[model samples]
Target: AELSRLLVLKPEILLLDEPTNHLDLPAIIWLENFLRTTKCTIILVSHDIEFLDKNITRIFDISQNTINDFKGNYSKYIIFREKEIERQIRQKKNQDRYIKQTNMLIDKFRYKKNKASFAQTLIKRLEKMEKIEIDAFDISSINFQFPPPLHCGKIIFQSKMLKKTFGENIVFHDLDLDIYNGDRIAFVGKNGCGKTTLTRIINGELECEGYFKKGEKVIINYFAQNQNELLDPNMTIIEYIESIPTEKSVSQLRGLLGSFLFSGDSIYKNIKVLSGGEKAR
Candidate 1:
């Protein structure tokens, strides 16, 4: 509600750094839709892959002390980024051949007066040639893998005889469902059918007198999807993470954060200034 009011000014070129931080899924969706139609440019930094994918048109990627300019939305950026990397690799190969040839020629003829005659030209040639600019460091790499989640028996959670209704409208009634550990499902429905309400009920956040049971060893990490609301306009990334409880040593946290793809001075950055993608990462 507060953010909605704030956005009413329709600020242009919203320098949103992870604007979706504390927002719920619905709020995130609202932002996506708004940005899609909003005339202003949005410089979004977010780790919400899906949201960025759906809305953004440009990406300025800084890596290894150089900025990468890509000319489209995130999905297009992905396509072009891979191709650009390949292009850079090829450029390095070509640059290597140039350096090898130049060095060998210089070594072969450095001692003779006749060779010295051509040395000036050679020196000028080398000086004027473009320098090879390979990336200063390699981003980390490993085969992507998913961790084995704690295995529960057949049914992970169950809800029975669930019902919900607003003052004058019935959303759902007498619902029965069983969710298994390995099952991937989308709790989907049209707008205002209380799909989110069901999740809240199962999460025990809603007052439900009916049947709701949790299996053993359930570890729930609620990564609330509200990207826009999570942002504190004044907070930077490093400062914000320090405020949270972490088991990681500072160096360990730094290493882990690096793997998640943040780097350089990004650690010292404020949450408010970070893109949603950066924070999410």
Candidate 2:
């Protein structure tokens, strides 16, 4: 809907940041087609490699307080960047060697009256030469791993004759399903196709006429679409996180929060004033 509104204005330039976050596959494909066909220049910030490769002609990479421009897609930009870094490293080594030779010449001839002119000339040359400074390159890797799952029965969830409705509007009827352990399932359909409704019914958030049972030791962790709405507006970020039961010390908790990109005074920020992305974090 927002994309449609933006297109109606027919702007010459478009700026998008993480545009695919909540988009379905079909919607994403449609967006790709629309952007590819438009004459408008687009500047987008996305971590989606496939999307960038398909739509973008150029890349502006920001690193170490500098913007490096590349005349190609994401993959090509990466290759170009690596080669550029190697060239810069070689140039810096050569510059260092020239400066060292100039210093040596100045030091060895400074006292000799005949070579004093040569020493002064070298000093002037050294003073006028521009020194090359290398930017700090960060190659730190993040620690990312999922926790082990708890023990559970063979059957995770079993449902029969599941019927969910909101007043006279039926979401789904006579839905029978048996989800087993280690099973991977995806519910995909157009909007208002009972996906969310079915999940809500399964989670017991909404009442439905059905036979639903969970296996022994079954645990459910439900993440709502509007999860940010559930945050307490009165609580500061740190205070809110600390409310949860944990064995971690205060410093450990802060470290954990920093890993999530919440650091310094931002931890004291009230949940009410945080942006959508921040609150979602």
Candidate 3:
């Protein structure tokens, strides 16, 4: 609604932050078209690479305490940034090698009376050379994998004539489902289409009219769509992960969080201070 209002006003300059956060597919598509054709100069901050690639003509990359402008979309910017980093790395390596060789020459000849002047010249040249500094790249990625489920019956879940309603609105009705041990399922629909509601019901987090049954030794590890909202705001990342009932020790837990790119002092940061992406992770 806020985005709709902003678009209606047709402001000369539009600034948006994570505009596709909770938008459905259709809404995201419409927004992409609108932004592509809009006359306004837009400054958008989004982690949605596809959205940015579709709508943006330029990129402003904030890194190393600087804002670097690139003259293309997200994909192009990635290519260009990588090339730039490679160039910087090469230059730094060459410069370091030169500096090292020059220092060695200076040290070897500085004590000799005949080469004192040459050593002094080398020192002066080294002092005058500009040092190359490369920006730090964080390439850490999540590495944890889900453990294999314990042995269970082939029929994992079964439901018959499942129905859900809210007041006068019937979200879904007369639905039958059977989930097998190795079956992979995806529930896709537009906003408020009961996908989440159905999942919640299956997880026993919500009441529903249904004949539902779990197979022997079945276990459900549910991650809600609004999982970030369920986080304890005052708890640190490490504290929150530790609160879960697990046999992993502090060091192992830290390694797990590190795999999720939460390293160093970031593991100690309160959940309230984390960004949306960090919270989601």
Candidate 4:
């Protein structure tokens, strides 16, 4: 409902600051889908690297009191920045030609007999000129491992001419995409570019015209933005979770709930009647 409200405002540019900070998993993904389908100019500041990479196409970086603009998604920014630093280094290496030429002219003219003070001053000025400054580049980096890929049957799914619109806003047009079992796909672009829209059309519920297809026995399950409702109004916080069948051991579940700020009798409170902070809990 909040997202639908935002969509009604007809903004040409959107600014998001840690927009996912308080969102549950489903809400986070719903935002992801919503942003993916949006075609507005968006500027986002987020600590969520995966979300940033999946959504934003440009990076504006401020470092050491200087600002740098990179015309690519976050992942490409890393690759392009490394290459750019090397290019700048090469250009600066050739700048020695300026100093060497100046020195040569000084050597040739300095010994002229009875040279004036003005000439001496000129030589001194040339010698004192500082080298152009181009600072060395530094890029912070981290490496992590992902879960092993699960194999799916070939011809995973297909969609024909999916469509979406919000009043006058048209999110997609005649879109077609096919997924295969072994494909490891990464959607790259700025936020609100339809990555999430396509996900919705594939799963059904989002409106579409042309036929969509999927290989046999494909399973689809998503925790949409409304997963917060799972907190349950009628049940106590602990009772809400206890009602669900979970594979987690009891100790692990308690630890997880504690992380979300529910512990002891606090979990025993009826969530439907809980305060905002407690529901957030």
Candidate 5:
């Protein structure tokens, strides 16, 4: 909705940061097309590799307190970055060798009275020489693993002749499917295709014209795309997590939050003050 509002303004330049956060696949596709055809200068900060590959024409990589501009998509920028790193390494090696040789000459001359003048000259030269420092590539990688799910029954859900419609617009008709335990499924289609609608119907959040059945011990934990919308803005991070019923201890909860990068004092921060990424976590 925010993206749509921004688009309607028809700004000559657009700046977006993680614009795809709550978007469904279809919405993302629409945005990709929109960006491709728009006559605006776009500046995007995104972690969506595929989206960046498809939409962006240039990249401004922030590293070592500098913005390195690359005239290409994310993939090309990656290639360029690797080559640049290699070049930097080579330059540093050469600079180190030169500095070492100069220092050795200075050291040899410093002791002799006759070479003292040359040593002073070399010392001055050394002082004037620009030192080369290698920027440390200390990139931190995040690893998150979900707890193994409980073993479910043979048939998790089965739907027959399922159909959904909003007024005159029909999303799906005569859809039949059998979902078993541990079955991974992904819904793909254009906007307003009723993917969410179908999920709601199956979850009993919405009524539908069809037959839907669930096996025994089938528990659904739905995480909406707009998950931040569900968070209590009035609650603090720790308080919000505590609000949910769990068997874990307070220390365990804190550890879990820490894994989400909400450590120490940050857990006390109010949900309203948290950024989009924090709220999402």
Candidate 6:
């Protein structure tokens, strides 16, 4: 609704932050098209790389206390940023080597009266030299991987004549679904189109007019779209993770959390204090 209002105004400049947060796939597609065709100058901040790639012509990357401008889309910016980082690394290495060599030369002649003047000259030049600084980048890979589920029958889930309704509004009706072991599936639809409703029904979180059965040893771990809301606000990140029935030790768990970019004291932060992204993580 807020986005709709913003679009209705047709401002000369549009500034959007995470505009696709609760938007459905179709709505996101529509937004992409609108952005592409709009004549307004837009400054968009989003984590949706695909959306940015399609809608944006330029990028203003804010990092390391600086804003760097890139002359293309997000995909192009990624490549350009990497090459730029590599160049900076090489330059810093060369500069470090030169500084080290100069220091050594100065030390070698500093005590000698004959070359004291030369040492002073070198010292002045070295003092005047600008030091190169490389931006710190975290290259740590995310180490999150679900543990393999216990062996189950081939038919993981089966549903027949499924129907769901909210009061008098029919969400979906006469739907049949079969989910087998090793089958990857995605449910996509417009907002309020029963995608999440169907998922909830399948997860046994909602009462539906349907025949649903789970195969033997079938364990469903549901991560809802609003999963963060289900978290215990009083619990710290480490405490919440520890509550899960896992065989991992404290150090191992800490390492796992670190892989998710929650290192050091961050794991001790209460869930209530975390940002949406951090809570999701």
For each candidate, what TM-score against the reference?
Answer: 0.63, 0.79, 0.93, 0.40, 0.71, 0.92
**Reference-based lDDT, residue 219, model 1:** 58
Cα error of candidate 4 at position 53, Å? 1.8
- Estimate the overall C-alpha local distance difference test score of candidate 2: 0.86
lDDT of 5 by residue, 171-268 (tens): 88899989898889997666567777877776778888888898788888787777789999999999999999999999989989888878889999
Stronger candidate by lDDT (1 vs 3): 3
Residue-pair clash count for candidate 1: 27
Off by over 4 Å in 3: none
lDDT of 6: 0.89
> TM-score for model 4?
0.40
Q: Which 10 residues in a row give candidate 6 its minimum summed lDDT?
A: 134-143
Q: Note each model's CA RMSD in angstroms.
A: 6.1, 3.4, 1.7, 16.0, 4.4, 1.9
Candidate 4's C-alpha runs over 4 A off are 1-5, 97-101, 104-108, 113-132, 135-281
lDDT per residue for candidate 2 within 1-281, as digits (tens), equals 99789989999999998898778889899999998999999989887999999999998887667887779999998787778778888999999999998899999999999999999999998899887766544443444355678999999889999888888998888989999999988889876788888787667687788898878988877888889999999999999999989888999888878877788999999999998878977
CA lDDT of each prediction against the hidden true structure:
0.72, 0.86, 0.90, 0.71, 0.84, 0.89
The sequence of per-residue lDDT tens digits that candidate 1 reaches over residues 1-281 is 66676588778767777677656577778888888888887787776778888887777777677777777777887777777778888998998798788778877777678897576667678888887665443445533344588766777788788777766677788888898888888875554667677777766667654687877787555544554566675776656666679786877666666666666887777666766556666
Which is better, 2 or 6, measured by TM-score?
6
Candidate 5 colliding pairs: none
Candidate 4 CA-lDDT value: 0.71
> Number of the top candidate by TM-score?
3
lDDT of 6 by residue, 44-116 (tens): 8898898888888898877656777878999998888788789999999999999899899999999999999
Lowest lDDT sum, 10 consecutive residues, model 5, at 134-143
Arrange candidates by lDDT, descending.
3, 6, 2, 5, 1, 4
Count of steric clashes across candidates, in order: 27, 0, 0, 6, 0, 0
